[model samples]
Target: MRIVVADDSFLLREGLQLLLAEAGHDVVASVADGPAFVAAMREHRPDVGIVDVRMPPSHTDEGLRAAVDVRREWPAARLMVLSQYVEVSYAEELLAAGEGGVGYLLKDRVSDLDDFLAGLSAVAQGGTALDPLVVRQLMARRPDPLAGLTPREREVLALMAEGRSNTAIAAAMVVTPGAVEKHTQRIFAKLGLLAGDDAAHRRVLAVVRYLRAAGG
Candidate 1:
């Protein structure tokens, strides 16, 4: 896989480059600031981009804004953002860009190389990989709409929001695929999401609803 890394921290940026290279992936470009990150994206068009939520200048949301710009200009760009804290608004903004190929993880997660790499891989393959902490924050912020759901239903919906497929959700929940499908249907109905023949579209709608209800 080809990757582009953007972070204001010199040590973290260099460490990521070395880490990806050691993992047999090509680090096409490593940049420091948001503008350079955008330029690298246009020039290299890497398979996946790993970006810090904050960058140079204000060290505020420069990297996140760059990610949004890249997504706008290049809709197919896959992005995995690392943040020091769980910001529901930022996660909402990132998810609002599209259905999949996006991730929002906390910086602490970087120490778990396997999980971090898996998240990037998932995003590159057109899937979502939100950090568990972010999910919990979102869930904790608003619980009214979800209050109507059964505990089992809530569990299934949470995994759906994480972009898990039915099979994956089933395996994780230790249930059969048919049971997973049934739970998904109930979730959609309870959430008032329109029933559709397109599975992916329905899944996206469900996730969007989940995020919105969670104060995203």
Candidate 2:
């Protein structure tokens, strides 16, 4: 997969480039800032983009905002938002990209080379990959609307929160996708969330609810 690496930190940028290249993926452009990353994407249109959340020109969510814009123009392009810490809003926006090629992970996760590459691949193939830490933080923050749910139901809801389709969730749970759909319907019923809401609305609200309750 062709990729663009964007990070203000030289070491992190070079390290990611090397990692992706070593994994036999193309690192088409290694840029130091978000604007340049955007320009590189416009020029090369890489299959995936790995961007640090904090880049130049305010050094706060520039890369994240860039990712949002990139998706707006090129919705097919995959994206990975690399954050220094557990950034809930950034993760929420990126993962709320409707189960497409989207990922939100932490810098520490880069140390797990195989998992990191797997995450990129997941995004490249139009999947969602949220960092465990981000998930934990988010799970901690939202009030639990489904606290009354069974442990099994909670598991299904967590997967749903990750934007997994019913089929995908069922596959993960080794059950019929319809079963997963039923669990999802039950979860929403318990949470009082209406069915047929768009992915963004479902996800952001899910995050809000999870943080309120989990605190785990």
Candidate 3:
């Protein structure tokens, strides 16, 4: 996969480039700060973009805002945010922007290199890869939207937010696919997602609802 690495830290930018190169992916552009990241993204249009939440000049949300801009310009852009802090509002905004190939992972929580690579691959393939910590923070911040769900239903919802398919969720839970489907239906129904909604639409809707409930 061709990629772009964007971060304010020189070491991190080089480290990610090296890691991606060793993993058989091309780092087409390595940039520091947000505007350059956006320019590189427009020029390279990489398969996936890895970015930190903060960047130079502001050290606030430059990279995140850049990701939003990139997504706005190219709706199909695949982006994965690597940040030390959750930055809840923008993270929610990023997730709610669109459904395809989006991820937000905490830098410290990514202890397993293989798992991190797998998550990146998942996002590049138009799937989600929400970090469990991010999910937990969102859930902890809001309780009203998910009030109707049972514990089991909530478990299924969390996995759904992580972009896991029913088969994968079933394997993780050691349950059958049919059982996973039933739980998913229950989740959708409780979340007010109509049965007539397309499956993928409903799934993303359900996950977005969880994120939207997370207060800014």
Give the clash count for each candidate: 0, 11, 0
Quantify all predictions' global Cα lDDT against the true fold. 0.84, 0.75, 0.86
- Best-first order by TM-score: 3, 1, 2
The TM-scores of all predictions, comma-separated, are: 0.82, 0.71, 0.85
lDDT (0-100) at residue 205 of candidate 1?
A: 64
C-alpha lDDT of candidate 2 relative to the true structure:
0.75
What lDDT tens digits, residue by residue, belong to model 1 across residues 1-216? 999999999999999999998889999999999999999999999998988988989998999889988888998899999999866676666776766788888988789998888888888877778887887888787654767789999899889777667998999999999999999998888877767556666776677667777773
Per-residue CA lDDT of model 2 for 111-177, tens digit only, reads: 8887788778877876666776777677667655555898889888677655466787888899998
Q: Candidate 1: worst 10 consecutive residues by lDDT? A: 196-205
Worst lDDT window (10 residues) for model 3?
Answer: 138-147
Q: What TM-score would you give candidate 3 relative to the actual structure?
A: 0.85
Give the higher-lDDT candidate: 1 or 3.
3
Clashing pairs in 1: none
